[model samples]
Target: MQETPFCLRVGHLLPYSMLDSNITNFTKTSTFILLGIPGLEAAHVWISIPFCTMYAIAILGNFTILFIVKREPSLHGPMYYFLCMLAITDLVLSTSILPKMLAIFWFNSREIDFSACLTQMYFIHCFSAMESGIFVAMAFDRYVAICDPLRHSITLTNPVVAKIGLAVVLRGIMLILPYPLLARRWPYCRTSIIPHSYCEHIALVKLACTDIRISSYYSLSVAFFVIGLDVVFITMSYTQILRAIFSLPTKDARLKALGTCSSHLCVILAFYIPTLFSSLLHRFGHNVPLHLHILIANMYLLVPPMLNPIIYGMRTKQICNRLLWLVTRKGT
Candidate 1:
């Protein structure tokens, strides 16, 4: 007799012969196949070029930000400390997805072990949450610096900043830990083919044969709780900041104060707009093309990390000056 197929072997152990048909396509193995992009498979190699470039820029830019902040003693303030945290989070966020995505696009190496996929999913979302929290902290730092300048030093002391950092990390961990844990409990009896580049939370959950409303509701709740709450905090902080800036007696004073916030505002918009657009597109863009959905999702991860360092490097006087000095010294 011919040997039973690997996927159906488990059915033979059961008492019923009729179960074989139901179990024929069940994924008994822990491997998942990642389709780089559903309909655009032919262009994957070309698509990888820009994706690789953006990932490289993200790595270089964030590292440069960390190095500059670390080396310059004058930058050892609350703002720069939060910036360092942001840089680290951005590095992790992009790194978690890009390499595997590039592997999928360029080499057609699309297999991701189940556990590895969960780990990737955890890192991507966790760091994204941490990045958002860090932005909130940075906004608070600006608010304190501008609105209550007299007590800024006392308010955001080293201990305070360190505690805030710890809270951001813990919040990210506590909140995002459920995604993988809940995902692990689901039975992926369906085919293990994921139709996107990375192991996105919703994408993985959809592969499960069980009812996934819990997972869906939990994911939505976390998004609103983390991103929504953080956005509100940031808005409130900036409102106070704007009020304080406009109340200043001199036009020059207002412009200078607003200048301090320009880079941060740009970074916030860069991060939020793409993220919200992608989330909305994923949920409600039923008529949208699958390739477009995947492309937007990939862009959301790439654009913010690439733009953040560039925005800060251009807008912040100190970082720009330091970069110029470093270049001139290297030239000599």
Candidate 2:
């Protein structure tokens, strides 16, 4: 009898990334294949049930936030406007991959078309960039509200905030669009498989036959400029906000100021800390076990959506009250 296939004999234990670099080298195939949810077997109930439930929760949680903000007139402000944008971005981010991911997890299909994969990658980056931008914007809102209360409304007018929102979308599109296009231009090798659930820049580049140093450098540079700068601005904004609040005369006013900022700060911490942590873990701890790395990776991606609504509900009393009323009314 002929020897078994090398892939089969190995029981597919090697990282799918081994095939990625090979695939990037191929001249004939323009598209790539993704091997999703690494170890989830068809018979595995533990993974499927929980994964499905998490996706459902993410959608419902974000949708409820969207509804609460849209329905309540009191929630209309630059801060809440950014909150709504954040909610929308969360919805887009989770929905972009979860349905397809669920299909693969529940069923056994892993075939994603080239164009579709690129589209998914684009929106994933788009919303992620938008979220980063809005976080920065939220910091500014907080800064004005705390540091320059008299001019807060004037500084963050509805029109001005709207323009900021539009600019963020356009800039995100500009920043990320070139990546997927550049990705497509490079001919993929015939036999590569993406190990991750989504088309991450590093994961994709690892498979490239050509030197992806330029692409890697470009991605890192953009990430540093975008995410790093946002973090700096947010930190600075909050530092000023804290200083202003402490200097206030009334305990009640100071408490209120801190409370107003608390929720945004929670969401910001949840979003940024995990992101920075995961980056460090990936870069410095590659020798660690795959399961541990994947856990951190998923947390970095998924926790923001889970915590966003919680932050909104806790920090913005109007939102919490309205959401409670809505739920109670629906039940009635």
Candidate 3:
């Protein structure tokens, strides 16, 4: 009958129309696919080997620093307290990224849910900013030790150091918390696949459907005002330290005063310089290769955590001897 054919056409068309709507809706609520290290699909297995090795080194090194500082009664000073906090922050920062990265490379498990990605981005940036603050605090510690050695003990007592640590943690959380929350309100109507290994602030913002001008401006503001403020204070602190060091009567005295800060200065340089280079390039360099940007980003998070312990071990006589003693004692 003619009625039978007409009814069949309407029924068939109905599901097709629904299917189109469903597909449109799916993109709005989908998980973000993280593309780990672009153009490295064929070599992912090989590349993960070094990443795994470096992660192992970072973990072992930072844990050892924590243990050495905690067990030794004599090491319970403001400087060592700051170092312990740094080690812990490094642990958190490195763990937040590397495990997920390994999973992506080794198992091809790269689908990160929206909330998880936002959480990861928050912690990564928070700890990074916290580390900068800790460095500034460390610079202040060094300045007090060198410039006002006579009153250093009275000035940076246990309570004072505890307050500094609290301030650093609070500062980072307060400054970075708004970033992800601001980003989350926008709908990501574009492809959900992220081009980087991990969910970084700017990288995630790029995938948004709305205008990211405010996000971009706010991010730059945080960098210049929060991180930049730390850098400026550090420079000023060191300026005073240098002035005090030069006024010392003997060559030996000046050398000794300045030498104490040399290790911390090196760590700061190692952290900021490469990271700054990569971030500037990512934001401004339109033609930079994807793989290169990814590599530098990885290094920025990794190298300092891996190297901080090694640098401190070599430069801080007390720590080096303690570690050496532990090793030899274990061998015996």
Candidate 4:
């Protein structure tokens, strides 16, 4: 029979005064539990409500971008093609995690099985890497359009763009494949309660009974490879773009080039900054509150996807006008 804690059964065990006294003398260690949102019960029905709303907005916004690109013949170009890929990535990225997150929140039980957790981790990392890769491709496309406008169409032709898209998908798959395999190999002899909401590789690795040195090294290496290298490449692309823009003889051409790039740059910054902060907090902020970590994680997932379409819509006059025209015609 399992021994019960004195506080939990004090009145019922009062008949055994000696045992009760012994139990009262014992000290317990307090471990952290994922209580989800504070001030709410463990199974609060409204816990999932906020995520559901965000998920809906993300879906609607990205779908609108997709529709605008498809419907407007004038928007057919290498830049818009890259934007479409980004919208598609955002849709897949949000869909991969939000449904399960919502289910746990609404049901008041944030329970996920081992297999499901690993799968979630895999898709999350995969899409995140893919987004990074696609951002690099977008920057390159912009560079070609502005720095080599006459050759832009010939350079980023349909076949070439399709190959670049394939490269992004392949790179994402290669980068994230190791994490799940390494996780599965670990002998999980410790407690299974994941302190965070999702199955993050670092968070889950912290629970493994096996030596995590290899896993940690690999995870950090991949983070540096994807995040660090991609940032450097993006910076280089923009530097060349700036140099080329300044060399332009006409002000109108300069403004047009800058305008084309402004939206993409805004979305890239929105996605990358939060992602870098989240990765840093996850790795180094072990002493921070669980809720703070959870908040950062949500921002990392939702902000990029949410802001992507908004950035494109507000900045791209062509896309904005097409959307407006569609709505106006519908009203008429």
Candidate 5:
């Protein structure tokens, strides 16, 4: 037998990536396959039920809040206007991921184009930041109402609320815009499979071939400053509100004061608690199951959107009466 050439033998022994630097740069595939939940293909039938229910409730509930707020002249105020903004934002967030998630769970259609994935990732981070900002805005609204009731109207006037709304949008957009820009700078590897149901920032960044330390730092700093500072600001706002409430002369006055803030406080907790769990798990709890991470992440988006209307509707008499009147009027 003839001896094999040293050149061919040496090439065969070397890794494909070692042969060419360009070969290690990027994936040939332009689309990514989302692995919805590993080891649960057999149970997707069961998993999609609660998800579909939550999506339906979220959509219907938020739109109802918008409609009632718009129709009832009594509901036209800074609080209701802000609630409408929250509803719209929730709709955007729910729409961004839920449809695709259901398709993945029900139809196994998990492939997303690179551009589309980046777009989805952008909105997910954007709206989540917006929600946190909105929460802080709402807390400020509460503080003014509770602590400075006499000037609340003059302070949060139409022009002022509009400016606050604009600022919220700008804050969310400006901070999160860098994330996708930085993400696209890196080259993806051939295995463009993401291990989650949705196109998330971390999920996309994890697929990059280049060193993403700078990108990760940027994302984390933005998240910490945006979310962490919002939490602290909101807590401080409530502290002031509480001090003012304590100064009120009567028990009923104090309870009524706290009552108005209850619904918003509920929403803040619902939005942040799951978010904290998901963020913590994503960053630190590597040993946690992938399915659990996905579930918590989904809840972070779903639970607040679904529960906000219920919490506020039941807590706020104006909303409850309006909703009931609408239903009974339609029935008649």
Candidate 6:
């Protein structure tokens, strides 16, 4: 005659056994409670406002980039093609987390079904990897355009660009597919409360009852391998491009060459700096505040998407001119 569990005792007090059935159903469904930015629960409504605003801006900006690029025949070059892919990736990457994040913040709805959580986790990471790959492709585009101007068009032809896009997608899928599959097999016997806004891999893995070293190590390995390799490639391309630019006789020629890459460089920094900072904080910042980590994580997703289009629109002369033309036309 052991004492009944407190949960069951509470369940017994409810009419029609509703609480009992809900508990039973929740157990079967295995939902995870997202405690979005813990220790700041009181300010969730206030927090939601900025997040919602950024999300709206990201959506509008990215869609405008896509629309402008598609409608403008002059923008049908390799560089703009990669920009289009990037805008699409940014849209997917931001949309995958922001809506659910906003929901958690605005409505206090935090229960995410386990499978749905895994799906969200996959999309977020997958698109992030894809975005990185796209950046690499863009860096290469600049390299070819500046360093090997003669071969720029012949090298990154439409077919080549299409192939590169496919490779980027496949690489992201292949690298991230293991995350959800492995996570699904692990037993989440511990508390289902995740302290972050989204189903981040490490945060989810921490809930497993058994050894999670494999998952942890694999994630570290993939991050290093993918990001490390891409950074190396981009750095190498830029080094050559710099050398090539310096070789130009006129200062204006060098300036023009560097100007072509200004937008890409800005976008790359916007994407990678916060990402690496967030990753390092997660792995090594034992004394760092949880809210800081969560805020950085959310910002990495939101800031890049919101800023990429704006950066391109302002820095890339063609896009800026076209955007102005469209606005002026609409005004009249």
What are the models' TM-scores? 0.92, 0.88, 0.91, 0.86, 0.91, 0.92
- For candidate 4, the TM-score is 0.86
Error of 1 at 229 (Å): 0.8
Candidate 4 — which residues are off by over 4 angstroms? 1-49
62-126: candidate 6 lDDT, tens digit per residue: 99999999999999999999999999999999899988988998889998999899999999999
lDDT of 2 by residue, 110-221 (tens): 7676677778888877788889999999899889888888998889999999999998898899998877877776555545566666666666656655677777777777
Would you list the C-alpha lDDT of every candidate in the order shown? 0.89, 0.75, 0.85, 0.78, 0.85, 0.87
lDDT of 3 by residue, 1-332 (tens): 22322111111222333223322222334687787987767888898898888789889999999999988888999999999999999999999999999999999998998889989999999999999999999999999999888999999999999999999999999999988888887777645667789999988887676799888999999999776798899999999999998999999998887678888999999888987898798877767767787888998998899999989989998899999999999999
**Tens digits of per-residue lDDT for model 4, 201-283:** 77776666669898899988999999899999999999999999988899998898899899989998899999988888876
Is candidate 1 or 5 superior in TM-score?
1
Supply the TM-score for candidate 1. Answer: 0.92
lDDT of each residue in 48-89, candidate 1, tens digit only: 999889989989999999999999999999999999999989
Q: Which candidate leads in lDDT? A: 1
Pairs of residues clashing in candidate 5: none
Kindly give the number of clashing pairs for every candidate.
Answer: 0, 5, 0, 0, 0, 0
Show model 6 residue runs off by greater than 4 Å. 1-28
Local distance difference test, candidate 6: 0.87
* Candidate 5 residue-wise lDDT, 1-332, digit = tens: 54433221111222344323422345433787787765566787688899889989999999999999989999999999999999999999999998998899889898888888889999989999998999999999999998888999999999999999999999999999998888888887534667688888877787676799988899889979999999999999999999999999999999999899999999999998898888898888877767777778888988888998889899999999999998999999
Better of 1 and 6 by lDDT: 1
* Cα error, candidate 4, residue 218 (Å): 0.8
